[model samples]
Target chain A: MDNLKTKHFTFQLKDLEISVELIEELARIDDSMPEYSRFLKEEIDSTLSLSQIEGGYTILPAQLDQNTIHIGDHCFNVGKSIANKFTNSTHIAIFTCTTGPLISDRLKELNSQGLILEAYLIDLLGSVMVEKAMDKLQAIIEAECTSKGVNITNRYSPGYMNWDVKEQKDLFAFLPENFCGIKLNESCLMTPVKSVSGFIGIGEKVRFIKHACQSCNSTNCLYRNSKNHC
Target chain B: MEKLFEQLAYCIEFGKINKQSPYPPNMKDQEGAGELTGQLLDQGVSADDILQKALIVGMERVGVKFRENKVFVPQVLMSAKAMDAAMIQLKPHFANNPGSQKGTFIIGTVEGDLHDIGKNLVSMMVEGNGYEVIDLGTNVKAEVFIEAAEKNPKAVIGLSALLTTTMNNMEKITIAIKKHNKNTTVCVGGAPVNQEFCERIGADNYSPDPQGTVEFLNRTVA
Candidate 1:
């Protein structure tokens, strides 16, 4: 097994370059709802201003045996869907990303004050922000891997695509305590609530799938597009 | 009086809280659900009539629209806000007559599942439909559900679990509630729950959306 090294990163909210249009698209809002469109435009700026994004990843040598992935001394029974996608992988990038606690705290505050609509919008905004941050982080990882002629596959998380969520503990084992200030509870839920963790396959033959929603069965996923073709 | 009811329903369906609220842009300065509800009560309309003819009718439209994908969460929440405004005017009358509600509903997110957006949406819809809702909040255990069911023997129970892993906990809670009282109607929902899982878990009903849950509850009471 190759020695593993964890890389950490912090980001300014501006680094994600989140746009109101992107949030509107994620929220399934269109030009017809002028009030909501205006509201999204107004809130996106303030919400992004308060966001504190951070992320990190650890690369470990890995081998796939049937449906299970052997990473260092730990074995991840990641299921056929993931194992099939990672067949060409020589290394696994275990990653965690979070939009920090401010957005969620604000959401809770709004909800407590009986501002449900505002809170819901903020909640959607937080999801977009964290995912956008992860996208930026993933791009960094991809760029670094590209320099070494190593390609990366689309990211996959434990709770999606039939992967057992309990395996989040095994995934977290690769990182230090509370890496990126995100903690996993016994139920495998992440704290800060607006955080995401997953794995990316890295190898010469591994390729990124631009639209992975087709293979995923999570139809109600927040990030899933309106057509379910994302 | 009929015109007032129609106007109030329109306000609620469009999510106009009051004359001062600037939503649904077309109805900018018109009297909204709040003012119209007050006027109807002043004109001798019973609170129950206002609820049945206006608020419930409006909320049902919102629910159907939400189910049809004609509207989304924020829009539904706005309608709920308008309903809240109208309900505030009717609260005193409802307090005087406790039997006016359709029935009782007990709801919560299953144990190990902290997500509550789906639960809250169902709660709001059920309440807007004139049911007395007892929300146990998120991460609620089977015992909590059992206790609530025991208190309101006729009440229907709703379980929500947004995580696939917590679906196991939902099944356990459903079994525990059924063990406590086999007659207690259990409805399960969430992003991850479906009719197939609901049947496997022994839940009485499963709804993919809040409107379906409302419809199930309406049928249970009927």
Candidate 2:
């Protein structure tokens, strides 16, 4: 089950079908935004067309030695946070997802016009959209691994665990460039800015915790308290 | 007629662009900020009064509401658009009557950060509060801030950064601004910044939200 590569798979949930209800819930809208329901729906429809969802993953066999996880001849010196996460995992799935550049252009236009709130809402939507795509990708991966008698653990990203964000370059090396029309800059930040890149663990009888938000420093995140993960 | 200013303020607060705008459902087809400001000015109301009374007052209400989380981002954007509509009506008056300036506010997102939502929010709120805002835009270098301060000595410089990595540049910008002119006030804010970081970086002030920034300007820069 190690080094399994599942590339070029499409999404099940129609990208636009990601409920506006979920976006609203994530944005924490209340009664104060008069007529915002209609406004958000319009923006979502416009922004959804602008979004280009792309995701892919390749499985790699890993050998965890104390705190370091060696996969496909590359070693990750993850800290205690991630080391404990992959404890029962036998394989690792490296993944990346993005909503492409359109959302970013929309955000820029909103900001330049001093439409702060509109920009902020769209930014939240971008996160939700990317996550929505990732959720579908995860579901497919789960189904694939399930038939193989392997259990997949929760997904993990750098900048959370002691896994340094500098390691983002490492993940990009294995995936095809423009794998999802996403690219990394010198700073390791994915272009289009609304992209997500991370890894998931696969194992048998492994316990998976969706997210350890309580331990995360980003308390202001909209999704921090929702969906049992950050 | 006296209530024209009040009506203008209400229009601005509710994001009424014009009688044609269908927003704020209840206010549909009613006079909006644009129409109200034009009518008030034509009726001989002073631009200063309209600006200081209606536009500023309206933004203050929204700012307070935003601080209380009573209004979210979309609500604020509508209000800002309404304010812009009103500003268009009064732009000519203010252009010729520059004495109505409250003070200058030069703002930008710190270098290495492309994020500007917070910076733009503060810019609109501050502008609505009556400052002659000179927005430097995002990824602004410390030198640009200092240069702008040199050009407008009375200006209070605002530095914004949404990323933790870029937040570090706040200290450098603050130090540069202070070194160039120690009396020039430097305000900082964003998700990753706090009052402690502000003090550690030698910034003069820090606010968690845009309204607090306006209130800070009111108490200090005003």
Top of the candidates by DockQ: 1
Local lDDT at A224 for model 1: 69
Clashing pairs in 2: A3-A59, A3-A60, A3-A61, A4-A59
**Which DockQ values do the candidates obtain, in the order shown?**
0.51, 0.27
Model 1: per-residue lDDT, tens digit, B35-138? 99989999999999999999999999999999998888767888999999999989899999989999999999988877878899999999999999999998
Could you give candidate 1's per-residue lDDT for residues A50-93 as a string of tens digits? Answer: 66689989888999877889987888888997888887999999
- TM for every model, in the order presented, reads 0.93, 0.84
Q: Which parts of model 2 are misplaced by more than 4 Å?
A: A1-16, A24-51, A62-85, A108-122, A161-179, A212-217, A224-230
A210 in model 1: Cα distance from truth in Å? 1.1
**lDDT of candidates 1 onward, in order:** 0.85, 0.80
- The sequence of per-residue lDDT tens digits that candidate 2 reaches over residues B39-84 is 8888898888899888999999999998986776667778888999
- Best candidate, lDDT-wise? 1
**Reference-based lDDT, residue A107, model 2:** 81
